[model samples]
Target: MRRAPRRRGPLSTVVGIVLLALMLFPVYWMVNASLQPTGNTLRGGWFPLRPDLGGYATALRDQGRNLVTSLVVALGSVLLSLALAAPAAYALARFRLRGTDLVLLGILITQTVPGIVVANALYGAYADLGLLNSCLGLILADSTAGVPFAIVLLHTSMRSIPGEIVEAAQLDGAGRLRVLRSVVLPLSRNALITAAVFTFLFTWGDLLFALTLTTTGTVRPVTLGVYQYIGAHTNQWNAVMATTVLAAVPAAVLLVVAQRFVTTAATDGALR
Candidate 1:
């Protein structure tokens, strides 16, 4: 006897396609605009029959400082966040401390406070210390915002490591630091990559803090660089789109490279 054919749900299929289109549309538009000529874009042309690379050239030459600033800040934020968060996450995951739960809860609660609220006080403090217009200062500020989330995510990943593995390391005459380096780190590499990627993306995309803290082009990130395309009388739409596309390339590359790590870390956390 022949078996009946299986069928997909109409609502589910429609919803999935809609979601896909919604995600893809912005990417499509960005690419389209990036290829458009400056004059054509300014005139509100919809499509580019004769695409040009002039906008990209202009963005690279004119906005190079912004690109460099973003790269430096992102790299710094990732390193700083991981350096501090890895140890804190390890301690929270592997050791039992008094008020551990309360500490974790406090970390989570800090995320609830708006960035703007913290920025107000932090701005004054940074100004006093002469850290307001520095790349290192921005990195420090961005890393602070990222550390709590990284700690929570890394803690979840670390907890997924079997307690027996840690105990076995201890039995093998390994010290806490050795166990962490040899056993915990190897197993938690995926989580570490995930944390770094998130931290990089957050620092790279930040504009409010960058704008408030940085006074010069040398420290202005790509998000602020895109703002330069806007003028009182005339906006450079082609350059804006081109610069935006360029800005997103680093994040896109990072995501592609670290996607497996992100997936594994998230799934492991969910199952646990």
Candidate 2:
């Protein structure tokens, strides 16, 4: 027998809508502010009945390069973090190595350290290695934020894979590397996507490394661009808000596009 889907009551639905509206009001406010004329955002009305697109034009003209820099760094960080984390996660999950618990504990401990501390330390190293003000430096620094968490996420998911499955692969004359590449990775797609999404978001929104590692306008990320914009004591509030909205678009789009995969990754451990 099929079970009927449970439907929410009218009052519950109404409350949910109200809560959703409340949560999104800030976003609405940002859009409203962005559409207002320069220097008049504070006096602007709630809705943009006569929307002015000047702010968007200004933002695109001034911050377009920063947006591209952010995208490159974020994407690079995701690739590097996943490459390093996935293999470590798989090894830790499948092998009974000595001090594995200690290694896991250390990974967890890295999360407790403040990001500014990491940035400060990397600043000197980057300067010495001539990596300062470079996209590679930004990617390497930001990967720290994602690698540890990704390792944990992938390890937990990989552990739930049945022993028989791995053993069967080995019995079929598959080498360890082949088994991992052909079977393990294919089965952990959800977890990989989840980790990649989070890593991209972390790197895209990162400001510490972007600020500390770069000293010039040549390599500024959007976050640093926003910081500099507000610091300049300018009255162009609309441009500021527009840039912010643009910066937030990637995270929102990723969540929307990968909504199903993210939900499945959270609930499902691994391939059955």
Candidate 3:
């Protein structure tokens, strides 16, 4: 005879739903607040029964250029971080060089150093070199966050590649660079995507470097622009909240678009 199917506990399901709601409440509040009529946020109702979009219009008008600036900086940082970190990670994974562990430990140590310290030191050098107020300067500074984390991720993924596979490629007359380009990178696609996604997010949401590295309006990113909005237009809470919502869109869209690659990384046989 067939057995009855086991049922999940209703209590557990309800508790899970409650936790999910709690996690998502802030986002709901932001959307709710964004839709309220101007100057009504202080007494806005819980639901947006009558939504207004003037706040979004104002946000786009005011923050659009900064949004573009953020995209440029974030994309540049992702490229720079991956270009530098990928090769370093590959070397660390494949080579048996002396002090490889020490090198990696140093990278980890850099992560612990405060961003303010790095920015302070860089300010003097940038002034001398004239990198201040430039897109290139912001990109380089933002990569300080991306490079080390990406290196750690890519190194772990590359290390998990079967030694026999790499040896077989070498025995087949493929050079190290060719093998890495064709075999290692192809196999590590998920890891690369993971690194790229995170690097983009890190650079996109960065406010510290944008604030520290730039002084003029020419290169302001959305984070800094939002900060300025807060200071200059404190009464415009609806617009401010709308800008905050808009700033989150790219991150949300990226996670959705890259969900497959993320799942592959999580479940792939290599790390298992």
lDDT of 3 at 203: 93
Task: Write model 1 residue lDDT over 12-87, tens digit each, in one string.
Answer: 8999999999999888788788788775464644576778787788889878878998899889999999889989
- TM-scores of all candidate predictions against the true structure: 0.91, 0.93, 0.93
For each candidate, the alpha-carbon lDDT, in order, equals 0.85, 0.92, 0.92
Which stretches of candidate 3 lie above 4 Å from their native place? 1-8, 267-272
Off by over 4 Å in 2: 1-10, 269-272
> Hey, what RMSD does candidate 2 come out at?
2.4
Q: Point out the higher-scoring one by TM-score: 1 or 3.
A: 3
Candidate 2 residue lDDT tens string, 63-98:
999999999999999999999999999999999899
Against the true structure, candidate 3 reaches a TM-score of 0.93
User: Model 1 — TM-score against the truth?
Assistant: 0.91
Give the lowest summed-lDDT range of ten residues in model 1.
228-237
Q: Lowest lDDT 10-mer window, candidate 3?
A: 263-272
Q: Judged by lDDT against the true structure, how good is candidate 2?
A: 0.92
